[model samples]
Target: MKLDRTDRDIVAALQGGLPLVAAPYAQVAAELGMDEAALIDRLKAMKARGIIRRIAAAPNHYRLGMVANGMTVWDVDDAQVAELGALVGALPFVTHCYERPRALPDWPYNLFAMVHGSNRDEVEEKRARIADLLGGACRAHDILYSTRILKKTGLRLRRKG
Candidate 1:
C-alpha cells in the first residue's frame, strides 16, 4: 500500500510500539499533531486495505514468569483439525495455535499450539487438556520446548531520504 506522509508518520510512530500509557493512541495522536479519532480512523482504513493485519500486545512470556513454553504438535484428523484447533487456541494457557501442512513421510503433525506455564509440569497439564479437547481426532502428538528467546518486533520503515 502507498502510505501518504501522515500514514507514513503513523507507521513510524507505531513501529517501535504504542506508548505504554492509559491512552496510548491518544498520546501517539498528540505526538503526530492529530486527534485520537483521526489516528484511529486512519488505522482502521489501513487495516481494511490490508496494510496492517492487527494491533495486539506481544508480551514477554519469560518476564511474565511463564518460563516453560512448549509448542505441542498434533497429528490430527484432517476433517476435524480446524474446529479442534480453534478450541485449543481458546484455552487460557495456550499462547497461540494454528494449522500447518503435514510434511508427510518424516513428519505428520498438522496442528500446533503453544502452551505456556511457570514450569514443565504446568505446561504438561495444559497439554493434557488439549489432548482431551482433541479426543479421538488426535492420532499422535509431540511437544518442542523453546531453548532460547528471540527478539520480536513489528514493521520498521526506513525514512525517506
Candidate 2:
C-alpha cells in the first residue's frame, strides 16, 4: 500500500517500540500531530495491507531464567519436513523450528529446532522428547549450545518520502 506522510511518521515512531504508557497510541499521535483515532485507523490499514505483521514484545528467554539453549539440527526426510517442522514448533519448549538449505560440504542437517530450559539436563530431556516425536524419521542431529549472545532487536523501518 502507498503510505502517506502520517503513515510514514507512525511507522518510524513505532520502529523502536510503543511507549510504556496507558495510552501509547495517544502519545504517538501527540508526537506526530495526529489524533489518536486517525493513528489507530492508519495502523489498522497498515495491518490490512500486510505492512505490519504484529506488534509484540520480544522477550529475552535467558534473562527470564532460561539458561540452557540448544540449536538442534536434524536430518529428516525431505517429504515430511514441513509436517514434522510444524509439530516441532508446536512444542512449548521448542521456541524456534524451521527448515533451511543445509550448508554443503560441511552441514548435512536441513531441519533446525531451538529448545530452551533452565539447565543442560532439562534441555536434553526436551531434545529426547523431540526425538521420540520424530521416531526414526530423523537420521542424525546435534545440539549447538550458545556460548555468548550477540544482539537482538525488532523491525527496522525505511524512511519514506
Candidate 3:
C-alpha cells in the first residue's frame, strides 16, 4: 500500500516496536504529535488495508525461564499434513507451527513446530504429545535446538531524501 507522510512517520516510529511502558500507545502517539485515539485509528486503518499484518508481543522465552527451544520438523503424508499441522499448531505447548516444502535427499521434513520449555525433558514431553497427535500421518521427525538468541525485528522505513 502507498503510505502517506503521516503513515510513513507512524511506521518509522513503530518499526522498532511499541515502547515498553504502561501506556505504550499513548507514548507513541505523543511522540508523533497526535492523540492516542487518532494513532490507534490510523493503526487500525493500516491493518485493514494490509499495510500492517499484525501487532504482537515477541517475548524472550529465555528470560521467562523457557531455555529449551526446539524446532520440531516432521515428514508427514502430503495429503494429511495440512490437517495434522493445524492440530499440532493448536497444541498448548506449541508456540508456532507451519508447513514448508520438503527438500529431497537430505531433508524431508514438511511440517515445523516450535516448542519451548524450561528444559529439554519438558520439551521432549511436548514433542511426544505432538508425535501422538500426528500418529501414522507423520513418517518421521526431528528437532533442532536453538544454540543462541537471534534479534527479531519488523519492517523499517527509510528516511526521505
Candidate 4:
C-alpha cells in the first residue's frame, strides 16, 4: 500500500503505541492535526486493505501473576496438522498457536502452541485440554516452560529490502 505523508505520520505515531485514554483515536488525531473521523476512516481503510493486520493489547502477564508461559509442541499427522492447529489456536488458554517445520528424527514436533497460567499446574490443565482436542491425531506433545521472563516491546517498522 502507498502510504501518503499523513498515513506515514499516522503509522509513525501509532508505532510508539496507542494512547491509554478513553478517546485514543481523537487524542491521536488532535496531535496529528487531523480530524478524528478522518483518522478513524483512514485506519479502517488501512485494515481493510491489509496494511494493518490487527490492533491488540500486549500485557505483561508476569506482572499480573500469570508467570508460567509454556511453548507446547506436538507431532501430528501432516494431513490433519493444519486443521488441528486451527482448532488448538482457537482454544482460549492457547495464547498463540502455529505450525512449524520439523527437522529429521531429532525434532518430531510440527505444531506449536503457547499457553500461559499462574502456575505450572494451571498450564498443565490447559495442555490436557489441548491433548483431548487433538485426540489420536496428536502423536506426541510436550510443554516447554519459560524459566525467565523477557522484556516486551512494541512493533518496529523497517525499510523494505
Top TM-score prediction, candidate number: 1
lDDT of each: 0.92, 0.87, 0.93, 0.88
Q: Judge candidate 4 at residue 80 and give its lDDT.
A: 99
Ordered by TM-score, highest first, the candidates read 1, 3, 4, 2
Q: Cα deviation in Å at residue 94, candidate 2?
A: 1.8
Per-residue error (Å), model 1, residue 70: 0.7
- For residues 12-87, write the lDDT of model 1, one tens digit per residue: 9998898999999999999999999999999999999999898888888898999999999999999999999998
Candidate 1 residues lying further than 4 Å off, grouped into runs, are: none
The global Cα lDDT (0 to 1) of model 2 is 0.87
Clashing pairs in 4: none
**What total of clashing residue pairs does each candidate reach?**
0, 0, 0, 0
Tens digits of per-residue lDDT for model 4, 1-161: 68877777878779878999999999999999999999999989888987887777777889889989999999999999999999999998888899999896999999999999999999999999999999999899888999886756555665333
Off by over 4 Å in 2: 1-3, 35-37, 44-50, 157-161
For residues 1-161, could you state the per-residue lDDT of candidate 3 as single tens digits?
Answer: 69999999999999888899999999999999999999999999999999999888888899999999999999999999999999999998898999999889899999999999999999999999999999998899999999878876778889685
**Model 3 ranges with Cα > 4 A deviation:** none
Q: Which 10-residue window in model 3 sums to the lowest lDDT?
A: 152-161
Quantify how close model 3 is to the true structure by its C-alpha RMSD in Å: 1.9
